[model samples]
Target chain A: MLEGISYTDTKKLTAIIKERFNLDFSNYAMSSFRHRVSVAISKFNLVSADSLIEKLLNDSYMFDLFLKEVSIYTTEMFRDPSAWKYISETVLPKLASQNEKINIWLPECTSGEDIYTIAIILKELGLTQKSNITASFISNSLMTSFSQGYEIKKMELNKSNYLRFNEKNDFSEYYSISNYKAFMNSDLLKNVSIEKFLIAPMINPTMVNLIIYRNKLIFFNSILQFDVLTMLTNSLECGGFLFIGAKENIINPEMRKHYKVISEHERIYKRISKN
Target chain B: MKNKIILIGGSAGSFSVVTQILTELPKNFRIPIVLCLHRLKHVRSGFAEALSLKSSNPVIEPYDKDRIEEGKIYIAPANYHLYIEAHKHFALSTEDSINHSRPSIDVTFVSTASVYKENVIAIILSGANNDGAYGIKRVKDLGGITIVQNPEECQVSTMPVSSIRIMKPDFILSSTEIIKYLIDINNKAFFGK
Candidate 1:
């Protein structure tokens, strides 16, 4: 079955972006990208992607908007509490007990929600001092937001989610309100590093203990998803854990061999071997 | 395309109508049927169970990424938008609501139009909003048979009226005529222009 004729226009539009801009979206699902480009086109009041692409190439501002449209920017803290609870209870404890300093990386930590959530988890578990957390994203637009220090936009929703995750204390203890934006406490940033990364064609700093890559895989097609998984696998040392979104699962039959299931329901898998 | 898949979407005053259809679709029916209804976001596991007791064919909320199977009825779960993959599987997303609906009618209808094209039969019934209007148009454009319940007979008229305005639907019948058409649609598929 083919995407409607306009979607064919969408494919040609993305091809132009990929070739001229050298941005690799070869991995994104066609259906997903078509829907995204359609939305972008609708925003510009353009009937076709052909018109949208012509504008994007000429106007840098349009390009930024295009980038924003393509990437799903969700600034959710502890979006799924059960997955967080599983990580806090089962995965983090083992890493904390192994060594004083645990090297944790969030490859697609869009905005700072993921990293800040982990920081709070470490603080509660008394592993804040012994954790070196690194967060990275492919999108420069989102990276700029992350570099400006963590700001919780949906403070009430985050508060509600945090309360549901663990209700022992007020979730507000983790952040201080400044200029109507919730800024994470300075203490949690002591052992953290944030950077923009190109995880696809290149990768660095192998030997990460755990990689939190939830839900981001849905943005890519199966081929890219498998390729990214393979890259993340090489980036981690033996026995390192890989956590995905609640709905995200290792689907490629051949890709399933490298990792062993930690929790099928949570979509958490552990690297069985470094190779 | 094997036996054609039937997709039904509705919002206000559709629960009883859906239950009636679900109860009538036979156990050995070769085709798979999927239903997307707009309901309260907090509902997780109740609607499917309620429908299952009266349904002749088994009815259950589809798990995210579950493979589609014939002879069963799949309901879009609450709070998340539903999508069908080209690989004939379901993928759920928490993307923001469209037309104030999460399991959005347009979202699923357009995707199904893209994937299944002529192999689908889609029906829009008794919704108070215009969620499924665009979807019905897409299905019609993609060469699938599109049906809208008669607005005069429906408890709510906004949905069918919107779709009917956008599309000269192949059939605009009451619930009884629609049910009878669905029961025989597999063997006597809608092929007329």
Candidate 2:
């Protein structure tokens, strides 16, 4: 009966984890899965996958940490410049035409560079004041650090990026620097709002026009990824834009039916009709 | 004499850089140092303990609604963005990540610039991405001092190089030199003897 317990037991054990944690290991590439499992094991100090499963069964905090460990929160400002450029040139302008307030969501924001970068773009384009922007993250503590705008050093680098975006005005005009610290102006960040949550709840369905969840799905088990994708698709309004990270793809098959690919290379898609 | 405030931002390779700069400062340094280093959410580590070991002054991780005091180094705790209020006190928010980094340097620097303006000293150090450039420009535009780590000396030069190319800070020095300059500036601004 339990003769091949080591190998078959591990397999059954993994299935139990998938069921209990609501994570589907099948979504991630095999290499990524291995890497994630190794990282999780080391991070949790579990001796084996069976141990991890046992730990998860008992500890909710450990289970939550496990989810965070498996998720990829890495991101950059204008990570794919062309994608941002496309939004600045196309989606933003269309929203401008309507003269209606717009809201944006950048989920799984790791450190907040991407959200602030989007705010800067909106400010440069003169849309920040008009639109109501919001970004959400998985961590409340990270959100607090981002809101403060304190960093060791990198303003000069951001200025270079602003120039690439053709922000012609003196970059210095936006901040005050003393003693190696750069303080950013509140005016530029005013309309660019921020929030924190794991998923978009149904209560706030109509508030967003664009949702940028780039590069985040690659870390999720396929089921979690699909669940998130479905949530994002449902959250968007008709003709809204959904920008995924360069490496991530929407492979639910049903996603293709609802959203049209705007830029294949940039992973930008547009909601075609109401689902 | 008004106490000078300094905010520093970095990521990727900031651990050693921050420790080096803090170690060089005096124990009785009469200023506030705020840090915004991007870190992973959850799993609290000994960042403050490590920084305090290298520096003479006390280093502490700031909590939500913490009061800002002179001569203390307040590190933004993991997973939170650090911001300064108009009253020069600390405030934390659980907003979405900006530029995909929480505890974003830009958010902290930008917010500080709004309230502190010319009174703020902003520095950019070793990092993998350009998170603080726009914030540095904002500080400079408000007539504050701006400094960046010399790209050649940075472990990860992308952040410093990008800031230099874009913002053109008043000074670009190595980590040791930056600490010296900070100490000198603080002495001048505070002691004025």
Candidate 3:
């Protein structure tokens, strides 16, 4: 049997976590939190949570592991066809008409696949040269991985997913295959750049015409979700477009009022003026 | 009485099993529950809303930095690991998937063990492959409590039986019995223990 840490230890650990991460977990379901910590501790080969915390406090490497343990970074290119379609059909035209520089943010961009895919789509649409585009990612490691354009052979599945999103073009045309790996065209990275930062603050201060922070909010507790939505609402220029995951919605009564649904099923919203 | 939290992990036939478990639990129950269910990347439907209709407690797809509260159930949204930070606030991450699953049960259960310790309870339900077994073992290691739905009773026995063989969970009851045990734990935590 796995020996659990004592309640006293758990309290100390929670305090340490709060001090470090600014996350308050007292309201979390206890059983679930305990199990997740155990898994992380086991991975570190540590015998106890207190010891794990000690190591975490002493070694920055453990912080990375802790970040990895707690964060889920799964993403793909053009993840939701309909949402992208909405961007192409509804949002893009408006940006095109204004002829304004378009700034797009992919807050939780994992591995740069999604940003590259969008760049390709813009290039195909004749928007890449005409419009100024910027994409942001959350993890420095992922940014580095994307900069190299070298990925494991595991991307074959994503190739199929790319085909699903853009059937008219051959997905293979965008990359060179080596062994089992698919290396993205170096040209795609010319205009596209990736930066690492947390999501909630990205929305404040950066005034952008469109933000595609899809599927990244589902992991937050209610307060974080609301906070992010508010920040997103505040950051968007009037009439800016906000895209979210198909399963996620701005359901909080206060948050819902700021944006009007553009496509109900696709979870695309357009920010309307508070006035 | 303090409520005992339950964490369940599964993939493949999780939709049906989740429905069955919700159907079996009484409507008046007050314990908090969390789940990690694997799903396709871009599909969207109100999973929490749908489950809430069947569950006694309110069902919600938690937001980032949302606080965990009793009498509410949180589901890992598609494509993210739902983690509990200190003080019961939730943290959603886009870190790489473990065992090929985002919103991995192992990730959630392991994180839970670190924060909840012996106050926790974990269950491995129906799934294909061995995603939750390591997580269940972690739960056991912490002395938090562990349960697995009987393999024979599950639609896919690989997950439950594999956990049984490896984790040696405290119970291997049917889905209905699993619900009963959860309710019993909730009562004990809140009223007796």
Q: Sort by TM-score, best first: what order? A: 1, 3, 2
> Which pairs of residues collide in candidate 1?
none
Task: Let me know the TM-score candidate 1 reaches against the reference structure.
Answer: 0.85
Tens-digit lDDT track of model 1 for A107-213: 87656788888888888898888888988876787877776666778787788778767989788788898887788776777788877786545556558888998
* DockQ of all candidate complexes: 0.28, 0.01, 0.21
Write down the TM-score of every candidate: 0.85, 0.49, 0.71
| Local accuracy of candidate 3 as per-residue lDDT tens digits, A145-167 | 66776553446566666666677
What stretches of model 2 exceed 4 Å from their correct place? A1-30, A40-69, A150-160, A167-187, A221-223, B1-193
For model 3, the docking class works out as: incorrect
**Please, what are the lDDT tens digits per residue for candidate 2 over residues B1-193?**
4756898989878788898888888876888999988876542457778888888999987644456898899888765556665566665544346677777788788778767888889999899988888888888988889999888888888888878877779998888888888888888878874
- lDDT tens digits, residues B1-193, model 3? 3635678888876678788788777765667889888877555457778898887778887766567888788888877777765576666665567778877777788777766777678888778888888888888888888888877777787788788878678877777787778778766766664
Worst 10 residues of 2 chain A by lDDT: A1-10
User: Recovered native contacts in candidate 2, as a fraction?
Assistant: 0.00
Window of ten residues with lowest summed lDDT in model 3 chain A: A26-35
True-structure lDDT of candidate 2: 0.71
lDDT of 2 by residue, A1-275 (tens): 00112334445655877788655555442323443555577777776677877788898787667766765544334444566788888888887787578878776676666766677778878887678767676676667767876352456556665565555567677667777787666566777666777544434655478887765664554466677777787878888889875445676777678889988756789898785
